[model samples]
Target: MKLRIISSALLMIAIVGAGCVSNKKFAQLQTTYNDLLNQNRALDSKYQIAQRDLSGATARVQSLEEQIASQRTGLAALQAALDKCLNSTSQGNTNISKLVDEINASNRYIQHLVNTKNKSDSLNMVLTNNLTRSLSREELRDVDVQVLKGVVYISLSDNMLYKSGSYEISPAAGETLGKIAKIIMDYKDYDVLIEGNTDNVPISQKNIRNNWDLSALRASSVVQALQNNYGVDPKRLTAGGRGEYNPIASNDSDAGKMKNRRTQIIITPKLDQFMELIEKAPEPTEGAAAADSTSGS
Candidate 1:
């Protein structure tokens, strides 16, 4: 009985020792597993930080590249401008002051021409309006006044100016001519042309030779009346005759023949002022050689 009790106690002690050793081994394995998990987590966090830093660095590099490219373009443009400035300086051999002066002079001359033309156009409008108002005083059945291509044309019926086959002015016609002279005297910058037209009829008079002589004498008589009687400038007067050739109406009927025989006064504005503007403008000098040539001359 004693030996069995002792064996049983030894077996129970061995079982307890084996169970404790197994529990210690299990605890050691669990600790090693936890340490490995912590190491893996730390490595993952470092990899994420490295990836974020790498992305930021890449973005910075791209921005720097773009900035560098823009700088290069600006440098290129500046270099091109410098090259152009140098080329212009060498080729033209002209200083900035001289070039500026020349440009200013050219601009002034062009502006002067524009101003002169505008003034001429305004004057023409005023003159045309005044003449129209003055000529409109006479009845349309007696006379006709019109403006064509900057010239004023005044046409009078044959009965208004002269008698049949005679170049002498009637008393009534002289009064009408005086009114016309007043209009002419208002404008001094115009030339006057007086023309007489006759119908296709054979005119045989004691003093007058033919239709040609009658037409010519009528035009001269009108011009003389304007100059001598009305005090119009003689230099502005011109006379012409169209006998049986230039007619406004056909001479087949008496009314048409009467219409064909008429007088025309044409007034044209003088353009001497425009020509003087051009002649008065300073011409451009060719080069610096102008001074040397002038001195030598």
Candidate 2:
């Protein structure tokens, strides 16, 4: 529209100048027209740049709106899930309570068993310590007092306890056996197991046919001594023979054979007490049973 207006103005100027206008005035009008035309071209270029900028800005705004919509949708889904979880927790509160009660009951039973085991271990340790403290250093050379797995084991070498290659109790064994028996009598609740071990050598005696006979006879002799001579309860004593099978060392060497020929007096809690404890085990609480039923359902 501006171009057409400018063209009409220039045509009017040419018509008027053809009859009366000077050459200077015509040149001035022509210069004014050229200035206006240049200005209009610059304005057109600016308009095209502004249109591109507006289109880009609109596209960016649209992208941001889409992102905001997606985020809102995600937030709604998470809120719904949280509400469902809260509802479930409220409805199943009784089941949760029952489970907690069951856990507490189990913990209590575990503690009870642990206490029983610790008490038994303490008694065994006391027995071992008392025996070790009572015997002299020379006696200890032939005796080994140890507590293994809550049992007191008094290992007496055959050299100190018996005659050479015989199950007969040595005359020198009297004092040592007396001391041991005294300790055994002090712990009335513990049962004594007299286990006899022997070396791999064969026995040639007419009465003792083999190592098994020697071992059994040796164990029986010790048990009899504890009962008859030292006043240990006969009911609390048990005799067993390992023969040459349960060797502490190799019997190929003389020293090893001597080590292998030894007797172990094992003191432990009564098996009947352990059986009683097993029978008295805690029964399942009502809460525990209810919890199991709920879980099964």
Tell me the tens digit of each residue's lDDT in model 2 across 13-112. Answer: 7886887888888888878788778766756645643564355445644654564455456446534544454468664655655655554555555555
Instruction: Name the lDDT of candidate 2.
Output: 0.75
Error of 1 at 156 (Å): 1.3
Where is model 2 more than 4 Å wrong at Cα? 1-93, 109-124, 148-150, 252-255, 272-283
Candidate 1 TM-score to native? 0.49
Q: How close is candidate 2 to the true structure, as a TM-score?
A: 0.59
lDDT of 1 by residue, 42-73 (tens): 55545643564355446644654564455456
Return the number of clashes found in candidate 1. Answer: 0
What lDDT does each candidate get? 0.68, 0.75
245: Cα error in model 1, Å: 1.1
Q: After superposition, how far is residue 138 of candidate 2 from its true place, in Å?
A: 1.8
Q: Check candidate 1 and list the clashing pairs.
A: none
